[model samples]
Target: MATSVKNNSLPPSLISNLNQVLLSRQQHTIDHQSTNSSSLPSHSRNVDEPDCSKPLLLITNCEGIDSPGLIFLVQALLSDARFTLHVCAPQSDKSVAGHSLTVQETVAVCLVEMSSATAFEVSGTPVDCVSLALSGALFSWSKPVLVISGINRGSSCGRNMFYSGAVAAAREALICGVPSLCLSFDWKKDVSSESDLKNAADLCLPLISAAVRDIERGKFPESCLLNIEIPSSPLANKGFKLTRQSLWRSPLSWKAVSANRHPAAGQYLSNQQSLGIKLAQLSRDASAAGAARRLNSHRKNVEIESVGIAGKFNGQQTAKKYFRLELLEETEKADDNLDFKAVEDGYVAVTPLSLSSTDQSKIETEVSSWISAALGREQRN
Candidate 1:
């Protein structure tokens, strides 16, 4: 919204009701996170790369859990002996929180004393750290099969695929059916070059080995996803295209200033229910929308002077706040060679998403006449 939240102070109707309370705790928080599996992500038992049947990945990001495109994509998926890096991110930087969560304070899940992936650090959101790591709250007998969210420093493609929290944690791992792979990077990639972060993790190691070979070949499609968008010149835009998800409308604006010597503006006027309220406004859509138009009018403005009061306000302190702007465009435009037109014609774009679009032919005639006129006004009162 407004070029991906020029800034945010949480309240897109409370992050859309915390993404419907983390999609109604998808299947009862997977038996309370597998009865608290020692806060998941800590089994680096590499006795000569002991492959205890590898494939638990579950990495995440809205840029937290040590972001550097998530520690360079967890050191390129730990030299991919077939992925095992586990992390449940978001202890901060819940950028443009889409599939929100952390409903009603206090949701900490720390265990990031890592030696090399199996990390956790969730105060929440990034779909509440992929709903507390696929509802095993943080994992014991390792479950994720594959979740890899961002390689996300920028470029989720076109209107940022509706305010990504790394594409809503790969749409919360395909709504718990699990088969996801989001990855992003191109806002001119160069993420402080370590050979451009290993050429953007060797350009997403073959789409993370083809999303773990389409979830070990079950190949889902009943509302599935595989986003990818790389290209701030990754070896000159390697190659990838097969898109659909373009709505064309980017040039967002909304400016509001002064938070009075901002110190989280006194906790953004004392947390009116903050799930990480960060709003400092001003962005120029990476130079008026993708494919770098080179309108480098001083790299077309991107500011965040202040406003990041999500937690630790502890209430009872006041000062000031200024807000408004919650975008959700898409009135219609089924497809026009989408996914930002294959990353603005440089290739690398793959879009396919689903999670109830609800136009099942107007759900039996216009959503059953508004649910039968609200149940006929509660049975005529």
Candidate 2:
């Protein structure tokens, strides 16, 4: 059996150490931001410009185009002159949409006013946004140097990654043969502020720059995308630690409700009524023409009968069933080196992900060396 730990179960000494780190870095960050403000431009160059010198970077998020997380990340990257940026994201939140694409319907894309970077808001999931952008359908370039999905509002650790639109967006890019990164914040309700998001974006700048440089030299790790999770208190985080995906997950529970109490029931009822009204009008037209009147009346009668059946079905107390999903707390033992544990301990966790099963040892070694060099730190054993 695996041991379970709660978020509030941290040792006092560890909490003290994190607080000290935060205090020490606060002044330094302020000074750094001030210095960069004078040299860096407020906005990035337009993506339409034929700037071959700077690598083109494509960014998207599950939180939609106008989210503060995405905005902060764009601001951070714009301040750096190394990459030309483009923004393509969902028009509305699709946080739990997974890797689903809008195959059944036509997806709409609209130009968005983002500072300097060319941007579009798509009427679809994060996967749809990236796929459309990279399909040579939306942008002039088919392949950007790198694709970044997120600065997401919530963590994508453990099994949650499978349900994350942000992670799916990055995975979509990897499928298209481009290196990608998925960034997320371990957001805590009420405890976390918007400034933490900006801090997280700023903190990830060095790692992003390093990844881009390695990518340009064809030295990025093969067959994997990076998923980075920033701790709740971004400024208080212990430095980045490379970690493996954990088995931790919040279990889901379904609560039963009456058909009439279900949210979708009202929409269904409204649509049925509208359909009946349309058919009734058609029946009236047929009667006026004195042709196909019987056929129209029969159709109208069927519609009315269907509506009556629906009403009776909803009125039943025990015949029909409905449910709503709710997440339940569950504990699973996670190792110190796992992504979930690292974030829980106030460290920024970076996990490398591949589409199919691969040699875990080999990938770990490669990622360890790559990130160590990227951050100018000694490699872990």
Candidate 3:
């Protein structure tokens, strides 16, 4: 059996080194920017030549580009100079979007300012962001050394993974033959603060660093991606646990609402208002055309209608319906080795996931052995 480490925090030396690296990187960025401002043309500067010495890392999140979770994770990773960072994330929340794609529609990509990272906000799902980035249309590099999907707002354990856009984004990267990691904090509303997210990022840095290093050296496990769940109290957690995906699922509750009161209705009105006169004119023209067509159809049916029995109704009234679904809270007892249970027990759950079926025993053994070696003495810090 692989030995487990029980430390709650990273070593002081590692922390100090990371801080120094971050400071140096920040200074380098400032110096480079100043030099570029004087010597380089404005348009050409955006198209930076990739630094071949450093491994490229792409980040995305379901909770939009400006979310604190993504920002904190990005900040944590910036402290490591071994990687070059790029971010392409959704412009708005797409938390439950799963592996959906923007089909038959034009998805927008806008360049955004992020701390020392080449970033873009995509007007699409998390999967769309990854797909676009990997397509070589958005970034200069085609394949990154690794793709990190989150430090998502909530846990994506068990069946929740199927609905998590954060996990899906990482899965998309895995599909494209790149190694990936999906991260989430077991967030509890009103109880978990933003600081927990920062702590989670800091806690996961060692595992992320180890994965990247092993991947570059071709020693990382094959045909699998890691789904890591950090506990709510990151700083007061047990050490890492190699886990299996659980069967637990959160039940859904659907509530009905009036059409006008629906959130979609408000968004539609807001969008139409933004379109202003053009949409109004178009609506008026369409209404008039529709009325004309109805009038012609009525004329054709007038004789047949007149022939119907007096006081007989032809149309049936139907109630308008609108509903929203929410995930309901439930509690279940599961094996400690399962991802969800491991997280609940205050262990950082690292579950190896694969798209294709394989021998479960072999996978568990491989992951356990790899994690034991990677973590080792560092976990004792």
Candidate 4:
């Protein structure tokens, strides 16, 4: 179910009267100081400690703690005055580092600020940030009602989901049995536009409010994730679309399409058996590059040309590097039903991902029968 909010005013009424809610059972440190303290962080209107009277909305990312889009997002959330938005993010950009934890190494943490918003920069992956927050390392001694990851520079939709550290952060929260949202902003010609970012932040306001409502109502789905991709296109009048992820093989890894342009690429190509195959590879790479450039463009429709190169092998001379940024995937009904497709179509794409799936009931599925079979003895025996 979708939730909605209309006002952005600071809720003074909610602030005057604090509400103490029980924390959900999740991962955290058995570390001292938190054992007897309230599950919610102490509320201070300073934007640093913010408000303990309100629930916590922990924002995080793989993008370094100092992020323009992230700051803008925090400002937007603060304006609504719904919850204390404490930022828990990486100290540095840990891109594509999926769900990694420094089990044996000591990961440092420090307090930081994005303008006036109070934030904590963790010396680890996005997942580590979530872990630390839940453990009562960031807040005074409270857990957040909701977890938000990213406002990422590029789309973390479709295949990117598997490799994106941003999405991994949200996944981390979900695994801890908390509702989470992975927010992303599409790139424009290899850069993230301010207009697109601001629009994304604006869009997030309502979504955040809705999510908070669900959290308070205890209606949030367990072990589920919300992934939102805001396109480079301005979403002034657009709405969000509930869509599914598109299919792309091996989305977790990058595939090289063309190497002919690079100095070493030509040498590698010459090593191939046929010149025809070399030319074909070059053509495919060029096509992919052109397509990517257009996709990154803010314009909806732009003509792109296909290119191909052949001949010569020398590792000495290098050409421009080109790659296909595997962002969106195509489906038969990509217009409305796919995550990346919706982003490209200038609408916010909302995808729901769950941690586990169901299995059908069968002879092997029966618990009693499985236990008996495992013992290698029949019921009679």
Candidate 5:
């Protein structure tokens, strides 16, 4: 019930119904993604696949499509005649998130020897999965040409891009001196349709193929990641755009009480509808209390549901609420900021990003310096 019932943009009953349906779909998708697949081939395929000796690409993805979409994605990737698939995905649903490492849990990285793909499940972050795949953990055969993350379930755009594990994985790979890309479909709860997913995959395939080719040719950018947000409709109808990151700050604040304080917690509240609405508002944004109090009229009030400290800007702790980080603006005016615009019928938005300069340049220069030093020693020898 974190949705507004009094909102007239959509009818109150319709909004309520859609919200329930959406939440249910989200939960179902997560649950389905968490379980391991039983449809995989028993043994690894030894067919006309690219030589294991040749360089390949490593793929790391979140857990929305553990079985169905994942399988389809793998099949499509294998359609590339030149690249060998080296994947390390989560065993269950991590959803469309980013860079979360499990320290104390016994998350296994199991070898999944399928027909068209060679993959494993890592009990780690998408970043860790890529690290393991690139390292000697999953594939002991060859170094990857690039790391392709996602084909994620939702439109990981605007501020949502920051929270994406798919994007974070790519960033991590770039930080480790690997070329990386993150692909996501324009998935919105009620706004987007099921056909959108199919369209997104189609749009992503050619761009990714070209990108992979560029990487292989050594023409790819150094220490950069591609955040390709696919449109929700047909490719021709839903045009694509190569875009830059939209720096937007959305702050959030809230307090959580003990579970025992309310006996009917966790489940949907049936009685005392106003109380349910109030609680839902609080759940949506921590700043809702202040926002609610300040608003003289309910004409067009927006709440910032919840917040957490994820990233920092200039050493001050920034809040991440609803997947938006509090960003530092160079300009004093915030109203004229035309940062992110939806691409392709304004139905989808693509927010391309790069890793921090320190993260990118440090490792690469260190490696180059080592090589140069070794060459100097060789001349002496």
Candidate 6:
């Protein structure tokens, strides 16, 4: 179920506290003494130490202002006031641009000035933002921790997975050796609303925090990426589950119709080989005028003509347009396979992906074999 905020607003008391935290953080940024500050989270201290303490989470959204899901998720993260949250998201939604960056353009990075968090907006791709955040110039950290790509307005799963900015950002983090989470929900282009987004985030945030905690504890395997897809219904789902990506084929096609535009061309091309036989039959069975009439009848039967000059002018350019967006497929695949039958039924899908340069074949071999077991099996088999 959605966690409803009592006032649905920040408490007046927290404002002063938040400012103090922000001020202190700004000073830390200026002084650069975070290297010696044990008080800060271990992860935020410096990069030399492999065991990071502070969870420096980089949260981003692909869909800018348009996504209520993205907005509410950011709000929820800010409300938590736990991790050192740094955001560098697009000023507007750039959902399925993959990992492409806005290199040539002058991208802006402005402070979001939230009540309880250090969030910022960037005019670059999600991956670019993550890169900037992890590097010492943007936000200094000892060792990078969690990088969350989205509380995206759409989904990222299945065959379209290759084109998801949310997943791509998370993958970019993994490539840089940071634990990451990419979150999304089932959203129809026309049916979804903001309230639904809050509901989904309510379920997703806690689960994501727990995953981050586990990663911090060194529980997860190396280079693992968590792809979370929340269902539209929040009531019925219990929580997290391990699942694989899926593919789907939507049933839709388009046809173009044009009048006086040689509609018979298609039919003639299709039946070209049989036309000679058809003409021979017509010639043997009828007089020249009769055959001409028969031929016109056959042509009319085979072709659909433009009604008139106006119809000919009214040609429709039609083609089946496929939306190969990764987010959309992710949302739909999660909704269909995750069993969102109950009122708030959504499941957190944990999919482990690799971004490491190590050979995956060696990794798979290690996973499948143990020295003792392999030797024993060899002797037995």
RMSD in Å for all candidates: 29.6, 23.7, 19.1, 23.9, 25.3, 21.3
Q: Rate the local accuracy (lDDT) of all candidates.
A: 0.65, 0.85, 0.85, 0.69, 0.58, 0.61
Clash count list over all predictions: 6, 0, 0, 5, 9, 19
Two-way TM-score contest, 4 vs 6, winner: 4
Among these predictions, the greatest TM-score belongs to: 3
lDDT of 4 at 200: 77
Model with the higher TM-score, candidate 1 or 5: 5
Q: Which order, best to worst by lDDT?
A: 3, 2, 4, 1, 6, 5
How do the residues 1-381 of candidate 6 rate in per-residue lDDT, one tens digit apiece? 889766667777898899999999999886786555756644333323332335766677677633566667778876776665556677776777787867767878776654344666777887777777776666655445677777786556554456778888888788778877788776667777778778877776665566556567765445457676766655556555555455542322343344224455445445664877878986997898998888788765553333222323223322222222221122232443332221124555544456653665554343223222333333464
lDDT of 4 by residue, 1-381 (tens): 898888887688765444322121222343334663555433323533546788778899888888767777887888877677778898889768888887988889886645545677889889899998887655665567888997887767667687889999999998887788899887776555676677778777766776676568764544457788887775653666667767632233344566665566667556544855765666576777785664466234433222234445355433444555553433343546677778778777777776654431231133223222322332233
Least lDDT summed over 10 consecutive residues: which range in candidate 2? 305-314
Pick the winner on TM-score between candidates 3 and 5: 3
Candidate 3 residue runs with Cα over 4 Å from true position: 1-48, 263-318, 377-381
Q: How many angstroms is residue 189 displaced in model 3 relative to the true structure, after the best TM-score fit? A: 0.8
What would the TM-scores of all predictions be? 0.29, 0.73, 0.76, 0.60, 0.56, 0.56
Model 4 TM-score? 0.60
What is the clash count of model 4? 5
Pairs of residues clashing in candidate 3: none
Task: Compose the digit string of candidate 1's lDDT tens values, residues 1-381.
Answer: 456647658978998998998988985788787766646543533312324577667788897887677777787778666666777788788768888777778887877655566677887789888877777645754356778787776666666667889998988878887777788765543344546656777777765665465457654333556677766667887466656666665455555645554556666546633522332122332333542444344335532233533344323433235554544323344354577656656667766666765653333333234223433443464
Question: Which residue pairs in model 5 clash with each other?
Answer: 34-93, 97-165, 98-165, 253-286, 284-305, 285-304, 285-305, 285-306, 286-305
Candidate with the larger lDDT of 3 and 4: 3
- Candidate 5 achieves a global lDDT of 0.58
lDDT of 2 by residue, 1-381 (tens): 999986877899999999999998998999898887666544323344536788899999999999999999999998876788889999999999999998889999988788777888999999999999899877777689899998998879999899999999999999999999999998887788889999999999988888888898888896899999999988888999999998777788988765567667667777878977987887777755564766666655553322212235332222334677886645567799999889999999999999876697788889989988878832231
> Alpha carbon lDDT of residue 320, candidate 3?
36
